[model samples]
Target chain A: MTEQPTEGEPIRTGIVGLGKMGISHFAIVNAHPDLELVAVADTNSFLTSAIKRYTKVEVYKDFKRMINEAKLDAVLIATPTRFHFEVARYALERGINVFVEKPFTLTLEEGRALVDLAKQKGVVNQVGFHNHFVGTFAEVRRLVNAQAIGEVYHVTGEAYGQVVTKPKTSTWRSKKSEGGGCLHDYASHVVDLMNWVVGPPVKVLGAHLNSIFSEGVDDAVHAVFEYKNGMSGQLTTNWSDTTYRKMTTRISINGKKGKIIADRQEVRVFLMPGCEVDGYGEGWSIKYITDLQKPVWFYMRGEEYSTQIDTFAHNIKSRNTEGENTFASAYATDEVLDMIQKADRARS
Target chain B: MDRILFGDNQFFGVNHMSEEKARAQSMKFKDTAAIMKVIDVAYSEGIKTFMCTTHDRIGEVTDIVRDNPDRYNNFTFYPGMPYAHKYANAVGELGIMGTLKKFAPGSIISTVIRGAMAGITQDAYELMKMLVDAEMQRFQGTRTPVVFLQNVVTDLLLGFNMREMFRAFHDYVQQKYEAEAGFFSMNMPMLVDVLHGEGIENPIVCSNINKIGFRMCGGIEKYIDTLKTKQFRPIAMSVYASGAIPPEEAIKWVCELPKLEAIVFGASSRRNIVGTRDLVEKYWRFDN
Candidate 1:
């Protein structure tokens, strides 16, 4: 599902970490006419060779060398949690725009440092919270901004899965010391979505961080928070549930005038008396995946993932740091996680 | 504790009394399919509750049950929290601060950093709650009648004199997760006293209780005293005392204990599972 190039010199890009997410990034970047996948790097020789087979891109074991030599305009850091900071730092310092994967860094300090450095370099940067590009959520943002929900009173979100349930050889994602856990690995997306859809939480009222399955790494998180605007909310996330096919997030917003319940595949809205939007009436209305999802050239993965990359590329061409997803916003999410962590540590 | 609960130690390689047996069970149940097969056997034998550790492989088993809801309708999970090895390895990899950030929620991650800079830590109570939430995530949509604080953390808190966490955990599990709280400990008598100090009466505690007193902290008499007099639910685990005692004598002794509500055991084969089931049913005097 390769799309024709959309005019002008494409943003030259390099990808690091040829894991599942890294490969996905490669295909989308390679196919998009607006961007060029110039080089890829990974410690795994097998993955790098696989990329070389089809695409004649520069391959390297050292991402630093690849970035220095490839002379790319942008880079995607898709490495493990431990490497996100160093890789992003390398790219931003070199004046290359970056699209780093989410749970942006191992810690809030790393995330903040990256954001500050990226700002200093004046590069367009974004975190890979692909849910922001999902049509349903985008629609939610639009309607919420338009006051379609009419003063959202509260919100509740749940993201549950069983991705890392069994004890295996520890990876960076499974280790707490390496910034692996449900909160960083999974809830980062959930909280980012909340901040994007609702407003940033002003105070963390309460929180529960669990390590049900993994040792030190958290497999679940439950938090209660309140927005600066007096909108209260709760976030529940888990990565050890055996029930889900993959990570699935469900959000429920209670507004002064209506209510909206949404997940990855669908959105159901209920308007209060006399609440009206341009396309919606005052009762329950539903939008399924087919209704909300945009068709893309590559139908193999979530359209939102490709859409997010496209947004990042377009933002680079326009010299806009404020895309639908931004480092500043991601930093905001990092700050929130830090707050919850400290709150958990400091709470009596 | 109404239904006999199946333990996941066999699947996850955690034999308390024997290293060799633990290793063997680990090898035998190494495959997820193998674990699934035994779980099915447990289910067929009418053991509906799986009081399980949140091991990575248990997720595979949970998925199997979740996929076939019709077949495992009565299935429930009593998920135990703070799998210690996960944290130990994590701390080794991420460092203390890094590990905290890893589990910290996104919204407050920055705040956590700021607090750390200012020399403040989120409370243990809050961490306990978050840990429970983390463990409960995988058991979602299933009947999690109770959530457990595993012996590692439970006893750690006991040693630190952080009895307040017991109350916090008890409250969080009941209020937040809408489930009862369970505690697994080697020192059942001390834990019972600690919970009592927190005003937690009739608490559910799973501990090793057998005739030989194998690994029975504070000896057998103290546990027997607590079991006989304390107004709490006792879920006897390691009734075979990690196989030091024979099955029939061990089962009879534990079943005769006062307030012994349930027994949790792990077995890889159908014969052992069926044998345990028969012994439990034949000997357990539910009336007493």
Candidate 2:
């Protein structure tokens, strides 16, 4: 479609980490009004087409070019998992805002650097863990707030089918040295979800195994966590299974009355733990979705590249953005993953 | 003397990323080097007949600015650019690293006509108009009329389905542009010579798949019909196509033709030149 300006307008944006994701992100900038995909600086030739197609935009096969020529309002980073820190730091140093893809920064320490930089620059920033807004998750939030499932007891999150089918050859996706593999690639979502519902984890003890995409990155992982509220949970993510494979987590809680299972589509609860569930002991009954979030569920892949880039376009009109996708959400997610990696999976 | 000349047909091998690589590799310089290498070598060999001008425009636009000349230096410069004087003079005068400041923009136009592709947008047309004006105003009307050593100029005038395989005309130009430009620039060449019965500079030319229906035109002689159709003329040249005809046999037949000037032969290595030169001396059927 044609998005024309009233003339003499500048839509400044910066993109980092030139990869497939970054290229697609450039498409996001391309199709947005009030958005000029100004400078694309990646360590590789990832955004060459992006730069040319959006003519008059500056490009850097290196980060320094983004810093130098493009006076950007915001920067989106999709770099090597490790390079995320340095590139984000550089953009922040330039006072450019940021939109980073997940695994926010490499380490918590690096994450802190970005947080500090964002604060110091006084610019708005967000991370792309856009899936939180899709599917029954939004409904999951509504149901919980409405107390549709009662008290939170035990949350079981399962993420599968990440590494069971290997991509041909190797990409940045297959390296632990670069935050590669499934635990970081897919389970980073689960960590975000856990935080979204349970606030934060008090302690996380996890064990991981590598089944495929064996560049020493974890593809299979099991984790159990204790929240500060004396509540506990068990969650597992596997990249080695397919067929019935997908991203699904059943968060069931037994409050004073019954229990509920909130997945991507619908939230189901046995009102008395006796009627619907086959193995429910006594007070089990089926309670249909009392409330559902109004978004069209984006199954399989996030709806047309997820996060319905429209909100982001409208976000351009606002001064602040808040959600599971806010920079706070990203930093929080990174903190959890880094903690889990260090405590549960980092060991050789 | 039969006015014949040599032209490389498979010059810059077309370089659009095949669908196979869509998933495996991101299109990048390292990936596109195969086509780039050929262009670099094509110029070093002094075979100036170029069918794609956008490729040359790219070299002159961005590469040299970054202190990257080794890549663009292998070929003689011939491109059909929009504005040669402004682009060349600006890039050349900018004296910035990674920019194309040294190449002569005027020489660009004399290399190709309307790129290897056609369909000029208003912006492109404007770019051409400004190019001619800027070239004349800046260099004092000293701009060289540029045209790529192209295929049937007359067939293009005749409309669709006239030239076999020429349907890929736009694509051929894009291939040259990508290969020569190191694969990023997209601007196409402008056709400024059709109705005026005009010719591009450096009359060296080549005929590719569009060689049928034109009489006495042996193996690939059909393209000559377009030139005849355009009320056009060319310095006749024979090229090495398909199997081995030996350089001597190829040159002899061209020399026997009414206006054949020189027959171009491709070489894989330095040793191949010896056989080509031997054939030229022993069997060249020149008027001399």
| Whole-model lDDT values for every prediction | 0.77, 0.47
Please give, for residues B26-121, the per-residue lDDT of candidate 1 as tens digits. Answer: 788779998888888888888888888887777787888888889988888888886765664454345444555676555344554443323122
State the weakest 10-residue window (summed lDDT) of model 1 chain A: A292-301
Global fold similarity of model 2 (TM-score) = 0.49
Please list the residue runs of candidate 1 whose C-alpha ends up more than 4 Å from where it truly belongs after superposition: A1-7, B1-288
Clashing pairs counted in every model: 56, 48
Top model number, TM-score: 1
Q: What is the DockQ (computed on Cα atoms) for candidate 2?
A: 0.01
Worst window of 10 by summed lDDT in candidate 1 chain B = B115-124
Query: Residue-wise lDDT of candidate 1 within A1-348, one digit each (tens)?
Result: 112123498888899987656766876686676888888888765345434543467889999899889878889988877888999998888888889988877677888888888888878898899888777777787788888888889988889866676655245677777667888877888898899888789988888888776787788888999888788999999887865434677778888889888876667889987878877888998765545555453322456876788788888888887676778898888888887887777764
- To one decimal, what is the Cα RMSD in angstroms of model 2 from the true structure? 21.4
Specify the highest-lDDT model's number.
Answer: 1
In angstroms, the error of model 2 at A165 is 3.5
Positional deviation of residue B162's Cα in model 2 after best superposition, in angstroms: 29
